[model samples]
Target: MRARPDSLFNLKKVLMNQPVSRSVSSQQQAAAPQSPQSPHAAGASGSPPRTFGSGHPPRIAIVSASWHADLVGQCRDAAVKGLEAAGPCHITHIHVPGAFETPLHALKLARSGQFDAVLACALVVDGGIYRHDFVAQAVIDGLMRAQMDTGVPVFSAVLTPLAFHEHAVHHQFFHEHLVHKGTELAAACVATLTSLRQIEALSS
Candidate 1:
């Protein structure tokens, strides 16, 4: 795979900062604004307990759901951006017809022993049916199963919007959020992977 020149240096920087959960906790602490009622209160913070990012750059597969191609594409981009932020990763993309199908495709890739991480991105929206919920659950469950059964790390940014309407505000808001999610999730993935490798080394 060709190394993306612009992203390599920065990604290495992120990898060097491999979290002890300290930076993430600190970030959370800073994010909490002082309550008007109480100027200073003891604050609490945490990140996803899972450390997905870390170690050498990873070879990853990003799967996007096609039901909303435009929206899901943002996820794909965000993921790539995230991976770049973490380090120079080798990335490949797979487009599935909808969120429900992403897990299967990801499963195939994960089981192939070709990629270190698999990321599935999608937007499951309610269209006056129970289908979105069903698909969301199934896909998530399947991804988990694949990882557990294969020891392959699977990361998801597939979200079910609470109140997504065919309106401009919702679209714009979610799009912006998706970009952030992609970057953040990518960071999380790297952090988790690094931490896991760290523990594995310690145990050995």
Candidate 2:
């Protein structure tokens, strides 16, 4: 089936622009500038990237919130598309009750040592009276902590829009936006794992 117009537009944009790789490289460059001796560390061009380095296909876990499964599924599909574009990968799809639970689930996956990376996608919008701000922060923080503790890369596409109403127009817009975010997350996952391997090779 053909993707919706918004999803198509987002997929095209991600394919053309590759926001994830650029964002990662930018961060590296910023660090390079700080380390006087490695002024060109980030600028130096390297050989063409391999799809993936591990002899076996990489394993990825996708933890999604079920609260908005329909919309979240778009992100998951787009992410799978991006990952396949890079090369073959094994995916473990999962669903949790809500955005608040994504982190613990992600942590479990990361610690299992069964996945090369874990990606969490959720829509944490203001629910009339609840504090989405705190929930969003806590989930993000927990994801980061999980990665640091496990040495496995973790990425999040969890979005907390300041103003989100339960309407068709808003829903459609966010669904399409999620498609792009998914692609970005996939790109980041691949790039990060590759970079880590490169560093390991260098260190050894």
Candidate 3:
């Protein structure tokens, strides 16, 4: 599943060729005076980050599993709201039958070069008929492989709970939890993209 050397080189070239907005370039210059290794350089110095997609709205793709429609829907909604709040973005959502199908959809989207990032959302629970752990592991591995092979960033909101039951109380707890996780995923997605942009700027 490793990417060919030439493909990696092409990915690096594409990143370098991406346009940098004037505002982002200015922000990067402002932060240049700070210590290179400082963790708080961006925040403590009051300098804005060189965020990705500053030149244009980023294209994002989301793949969600529909097994537990009610629960998964909450996560998807929360994630969408969070991304919109962050900034302008073009989001495409696709639904699959279950968690096992999400990785394939994500891979296809990532390889298409149409999205800056991909998000996968699902709730993997023990159904008492098969090993949920194996399925979860495979899904995660596939997602990692997709990103690595295609040089695209992939974010996962796939959760595997040890004990889950069809009860009102359990549902309420998970509903709230998924919302929190979704929000966190949105933040991570933005932060990761911003960091990558900063790295690209530094290299250039």
RMSD of each: 13.1, 9.1, 16.0
lDDT of 3 by residue, 93-151 (tens): 99999999999999999999899899999989889999988999999999999999998
Query: Tens-digit lDDT track for model 2 on 1-204?
Result: 886656755543453333322235776777765545453245556533437766678899999999888888898889888888888899999999988999999999999989989999888877878898999999999999999999999999887775676678677777888898899888788788788888888999
TM-score of 1: 0.71
Off by over 4 Å in 3: 1-53
TM-score of 3: 0.75
Whole-model lDDT per candidate: 0.75, 0.82, 0.82
lDDT of 1 by residue, 1-204 (tens): 887664544443343232223235777889988566432223523333333444566788888888878777887797787677665778888888888888889889999999888898998888986766787788899988888888889998888775577677567766777787788778767866776677789999
Off by over 4 Å in 1: 1-56
- TM-scores, each model vs. reference: 0.71, 0.75, 0.75
Q: What is the model-wide C-alpha lDDT for candidate 2? A: 0.82
- Cα deviation at 179, candidate 2, in Å, is 0.4
Model 1: ten consecutive residues of lowest lDDT: 14-23
Cα error, residue 13 of model 2, in Å, equals 16
